[model samples]
Target: MTGRSQTEDLARLFAPYESLAATLLGRWDGSIAEGDGSHDRSHLMRVWQLVRRIARGEPAADMEVLVVATLFHDCVAVEKNSPQRAMASRLSADVARRLLDGIGWQPARIEAVAHAIEAHSFSAGIAPRSTEAAILRDADRLDALGALGIARVFYIAGRLGTQLYDPDDPMAERRPLDDRRFALDHFETKLFLLSAGLVTPTGQEIGRQRTALMRAFVEDFGEEIAMPEDLALAD
Candidate 1:
């Protein structure tokens, strides 16, 4: 099959699975907190879209595993700093396995899906052993870096009553970077570094673009907040 035809075929095969996963997650209709807007069904679908795009560049990636993993990656949604956060991926993976079994997915495919889901979380500290797992991990992380990522940082902070920044040191230059205390600190501590660790070439390219956009925003923000004397002194 020509490359275009193969991609079209793959998309057709995964479309139903994506719909089923979305339907299942929609029923949950839950969030981590009352005001939490990130990590919802919308987030899942966005990551799934990324998975499809990234998978296109990775011929070795298992589309089935990637689709199932992406859908369930955040199905269990724990707070970022919760003690249970590290295990959230595993819990989601277990739930995914059960769901896949109910749909008559073969044990091997189910296992592949579970493993991909389990290894997709940044907090899980598990290296992806398969291309599908790597794609899922990269896709999910991609969603946490660009314009949407900036909004999510502030959204979660607002939900937790955290400050937008430390006026004296927005970049946390002298103090430790505490994203929990200041939303802007997240750019320094995590967002800027994601591009380096992205597993797939396609993901890395997208990560670079998003990271650049975020960096520009931070620079502009710092300039906007600088005291007139500070700008004059630099001049």
Candidate 2:
């Protein structure tokens, strides 16, 4: 198939899945998915929006791969602490492949999507290859910024029973998550690192600005913790 034809074919394949994206995210449905709310379907949608927005501005972007990769990046949940974390990541890719195949997507398209999904996980440690992969990865990180990012942090924290912040216990461990460790540690580890790790130029710029926003929020949080009564000082 010609390049444009291939792109159009992929778009056709993805149209049905695009419609079902909202239905798959049961947690973000009513009142934040009835869970701690970490990354829900709405989170997936936001990443999709960011990916498309960034992709549209790039002349060389392969929008199909970005769409597929973003959709399946978190098809399965990562365990906070499990020897099976890798297994979970792999399962997500497998699920993506199956769905893509079921939709009559080309084998090559499915492979590209699966590869991107496999590497999108923070713990996966796999480098992205195509432009689509890079954009999707950066888009996912963008979800960790702004007010939505803040809500997700606390939501996941509440799920794990972790406090919002505690300067006494520094973040040292390198695992998924558990109830004990404070959620703020996430900022120190993944969130802070994400901005610098973006692969695309658009992603890098947006990540930098968003990271600054998140950092400022963290700093304000620290200030509030130091003196909750003097709220006006933060302003």
lDDT of each: 0.78, 0.66
Which digits, one per residue and each the tens of the lDDT, describe model 1 over residues 83-194? 8989999998888887788778899989898889888888888988888888998988999988998888888888878899998788777989988889899898888987
Write one digit per residue (lDDT tens) for candidate 2, span 1-235. 1244333432344454544433322212122211325665466557777887778767787666666577667656665666676665567778777766766889988888887777776777788887777777778778877677777788767766787765443333345443347787778766778877887778888888888888898778776666444654764
> Ten residues in a row with the worst lDDT in model 2?
25-34
By TM-score, who's the top model here? 1
Segments of candidate 1 deviating more than 4 angstroms: 1-35, 230-235
